[model samples]
Target: MNRQAQAVVLLLLGGAVLKASFTDLYLRYVKEGLRPFLIAAALVLVVAAVMTLWYDLRPAATAEPDEDHGHDHGHGHGTGGGHHEPRVGWLLILPVLGLLLIAPPALGSYAAGQAGTALASQQVSDYPPLPDGDPVRVAMLDYASRALFDKGQSIGDRRVVLTGFVAGGGPGGEPILARMILSCCAADGRPIKLGMAGNAPTGLAEDTWIEVTGRYSDRVAKDPVNEADIPYVTVESWREVPVPKQQYE
Candidate 1:
């Protein structure tokens, strides 16, 4: 490929990254914390593209003549002619095509299915008392850890609210509520899940985001592991809700 083609690819890539960072489309693939870095990278790519353009557009006479032009001994290394661009450069268009034509969707049930249940952090064994509320809102991972490891001591008799996507097990199996937990970005994300008991509505589609109000049940794994069964929540009520702005915790 020529410098012009390379410049166009860079411009498209930079524009796509900048647009994704400026919009909600980026949130689907990465954590909110990565926005600034994405924007910076996009700016760098755009600047490099502009520099390429300037180099290509500057007056030819002002630029230094190719050293090979004066010495053409016909061994095919001369700048006067016979230089062939590498075909590998065309690979740059793949991402540009993906960004423009075959844009990918955010990670959802398909990804969660392949992931093991979220593990409780061993660093935190003790927790403060539950906050005051009719249905205390708790993160999915936090609730799972408390339920599985702490045996619901912190939860006590208080009701709790947890929000996540419906992963599986609504009809024949127990309903499972899950959220993606990201340490850095979606690529490193894993699913945190809690099993639901009582009257959880059935026929909910996979990846359907919802808010559930419930209390911890006695059912829990004695020795919790990544593959162990998820802890249970005796759901008191639930309702369909929009997906949160930050999809991961």
Candidate 2:
């Protein structure tokens, strides 16, 4: 393919990489090594396009194609055959079209209650105590995993902060619950549950986005709908926020 076509492919690849990086789907499906290559390929194509345009606009003379050499097809290069059409860099717009037309939804209620594969039992010696005086920022999964793995350990006395959506009300008409679901690997996911002890903020409902702040303490058991043995965090304060695009690491 011509340079323009190559650039277009690169742009599409790059856009896919960026989108995948932001979603749980990518982590669940894409391999690690290929992700970097896709990212780099997109950057190189973008840079080459800019440089080529600059070269054309400048007063510099253009060099003649090497007539003595046949198309370089070795070393993974493609042959530039006479029948090959000039690549239209504008075709890169396809990636933009994809972005506009296929906006992916965030991790939603569909996955909020889903559990990962079986839990891997591991040692907990590496987990440090919660910060003595201040709230500790931690991934929701780690908090839950630790709570389940080390049942006797107490964390409720310290502050912990988490972000997610407010799920619907629990049974017994208890206060509503806030949750974030993970679509991919459970290792990076695990819902951050907050038991709304106080008045839930206005406009809060099932799937309403929110951020909860509090010390990590044992709260009520997770809803029976949730099958896993994960633990819950007692929230000290809760506030609404924009829904995060991705819910996992």
Best by TM-score: 1
| Candidate 2, residue 70: how far the Cα is off, in Å | 20
Badly placed stretches (over 4 Å) of model 2 are: 1-37, 41-96, 114-126, 152-156, 169-203, 219-226, 244-247
Pairs in steric clash, model 2: 156-216, 156-217, 158-215, 159-215, 160-214
lDDT of each candidate versus the true structure? 0.78, 0.53
What does candidate 2's lDDT look like per residue over 1-249, in tens digits?
Answer: 554455555556566656655554453433333456656765776576566555545785654576324333342354433345445655666766665356554444445445322233454635666655567676665566566666526464666666766554343345344344344343444444444544345555567666767654454454545433434566667777775644443
Over all chains combined, what TM-score does candidate 1 have? 0.85
Model 2 TM-score (2 dp): 0.52
- Looking at model 1, the pairs that clash are none
TM-score of each: 0.85, 0.52
